[model samples]
Target: MKTGKKVVILLEAVLAVLVLAAVVLMLQGKNGQDMVKVSVIIQNSDDTQWAAFKYGLKMAAEDQGIEVYIANTGETLTVEEEKSLIEWEISNGADAVIVRPVPEEGAEEMLKKFEKRIPVMLVGSTASKDRSLSALPVTESDNYAMGTALAEELLKDYNNSVEGKTIGIVSETGELESVMNREKGFRDRLLNTGIQILWSVTNRSGEPKENLPADQPEVNFVAALDNNSLTAAGEEAAANNLHGAIVYGIGHSTEAVYYLDTGNVKCLVVPDEFNIGYQSLTEISESLRRFFHKVQDKAVSHTVLRRETLFTKENQEIIFTMSQ
Candidate 1:
């Protein structure tokens, strides 16, 4: 009887030890053993702006010891597709999400649903003024200020006189608030300058140079407010031999730098996309460390690059590239 009792006690002790070891392993898996995952969704995957942003994000993720998953919604910018990607990320146990939404009617509602479960950060755009989304954080450029500054600088080249001078404006579809605000700011600043806005084209892709009336007053300047527009205008100017027509615009891409170097483009307003990506991820990591409520409405800076300042060796890094 004594021997049997001793045997039973030994078995119980072994079972307790095994249970304790299993609990420890489980805790480690939940805490230190696994990496925290972050999901990033971009509206347009092919854009140079997002390319820079992704570079910053990946660098930050490496520094922070975290995992980042990215998805591109293509050029259509469909809200449903964005929501589907977010849903998949959430279902797969992503701890947080960074998104550049399409700003459609249902976008807010869809984001709010995700916010209830995990942290969501906005990039290149802001959520609506809805009180419910006020807690969401955003990282983007001040488009209005950038536009106003670009116009002011361009005016200097014309001796601040609109007398017999015509400027062409190239912009996006004007459906986005950022594009609209930029156009508005530029137009408002040029209102008193008497510079006639000969034409405002809504197409941002391909060469719209043909749209510039051949018989109209000489176009003293052409301004493109987005990346695609900038490229189109620069190429058009170079191809058609449009001399003395300064092409100024917004964006920082390899092509933009090329145009600047070749003298096809005069000035470019480049937003700090690298910083935007870096900061957004860093902020999201902090939120994971403490509480999600820690990060809110954050803005990045924009730089204006001119032909004379672009190749000075000091400004080579101003343009954002995938390899950089």
Candidate 2:
């Protein structure tokens, strides 16, 4: 009788431990579920670049276990509006928030404030001061590199013909960092070639009389260098003396592509936005997983993504069919 009672007690203890273990596993599953929620905020979700990035994020999230949400401020958003959108995401329990900033100065401070509570990742560009606010950054391309590459491609085909030719850069605005960088690179490259940059004008702001003096050499090419500024510049170019100048539209904006096909613009430097998005997620997902598992100190942060593909008439068919 005593032996039988001892055996029964042992069996009960084993069953009790098993029940406790099962309960612990259930709680752990719930905790893991909470970690899966991720939100990405952008200036505009419909923009081609952001769309491509979202595609990558979607694909990556599908392969890995994640609940991904994308929020944007629509087609046109001010800095304050975008900031409010991000704050709302954070307040609603977003484990991670990724953003493509509208105004770096104001946005950075807002993002930094949220970072104390949750991980805030910045995708493109940077604030003037580089404090450690971003959990990760994946950028596509910048203006300076695109401008230099555009000039190089032009130079390659032109051989010796472009050496003395003058180029014009038509922009709509001058405040964006990407725009300024491209302009600087374009000027530096052209002037270095001993060629002339005949005129550079903004859309909202017209050309200065002294800058486009009558004695200056004619602009052989006018590079419509931005998506937002292209239409206005195209109109301005048509009205001005550069009606038939070769036009290079930078960035793969829908209007830019249309202009290229209509013969209003010559070519475009398309940034690989999909790749930037995919790589960003692929890299960050693993890092995030590792951080959660305690295998790493923190998520792998700060990746600069490339965003330039030279598009031309010869490659028109390929570019046209691309979804994102």
Candidate 3:
């Protein structure tokens, strides 16, 4: 009888211990469940490239259980206005802020304003050092490599150099670095190989500026930098009867690939934009972990991951289908 009583007491003690352990585990999990809040401000979220980027960010956030707030800088926001938005996010207790600045120079002021309070990461464009902004996380595609690839594809059909041969660049008026840099790369290679840039037109709208020289273009090429600029360039190309002029778009926007399929554009070059968006969020999460000391991963330095691929008429079918 005593043995039976002792066995019952032992079982009750074990049950009591199990209940206490469950309660402690529940409390600990509750403590660790703090939601990380992140703010992402793109230059303009309405643009296709920005939309794609936001999609990538949202996917990552959903997987990681992060809270993200997205805002657009508007079509005509000034540097001061951009800064005000950043300040507002910081004031509202954002743990980190990722921004695509309206103007490259404008980033410096915003970075100076918020660096000490929270980490600032930039997407889309390059920034000056004074801004204290992290290097844009996307891989810097070798614009020159892209230019070289285009040249090689162009050479496959024609033996003559592009030097002194007129080409037209329909680019953003200003404030877009990636486009300008890619254009420079194209110009450098073509000029070295004997090509002349007849006239470069700057467009604010997705429309072509009326001021481009009307001389007969020998092999006019369109270099659209962003999604908006790319659309405007396409419209201008179709309107201007540049239908078969060896075009090569830099960003992998759907429109850019569509042009290649329709034979409106001869070539396309794209960076790993999907990877860029995915990596940026992963890095942001890691940064948050470092700052909050919730995880033991060491803080990583600024990383620039640049990847580029050349798409041509021959491989347009395979290439265009990947992004969608």
For each candidate, the alpha-carbon lDDT, in order, equals 0.75, 0.57, 0.56
lDDT of 1 by residue, 1-324 (tens): 699999999999999999987675452223666888899987667666566788889889999888998875666566788888988887886888998766567776788788877778988766553423444678888878888988988887767876667888876556555677678778888987778887776763332444442223458788888877787778877886444567889876778767877888888888788878888998888777654246665689888888788766546665534346
State the local distance difference test value for candidate 3: 0.56
Better of 1 and 2 by TM-score: 1
Lowest summed-lDDT stretch of 10 residues in model 2? 296-305
Off by over 4 Å in 3: 1-31, 129-152, 155-160, 205-219, 292-324
Q: What is the TM-score (0 to 1) of candidate 3?
A: 0.70
Worst 10 residues of 1 by lDDT: 206-215
**Residue pairs with backbone overlap in model 3:** 139-305, 139-306, 140-306, 162-194, 162-195, 163-194, 163-195, 164-194, 164-195, 206-232
Q: What is the lDDT of residue 310 in candidate 3?
A: 38
Candidate 2 structure quality by residue, lDDT tens digits, 105-199: 56556656765655555554443233234333434365577767767666665784676777767665455555666677667666657667767
Per-model TM against the reference: 0.80, 0.67, 0.70
lDDT of 3 by residue, 145-222 (tens): 555555455554457555455566665555555555556666665656666666666656434456442333545555
Report clash pairs, candidate 2: 140-306, 140-307, 141-307, 270-309, 271-307
| Residue 196 CA displacement from its true place in model 3, Å | 1.1
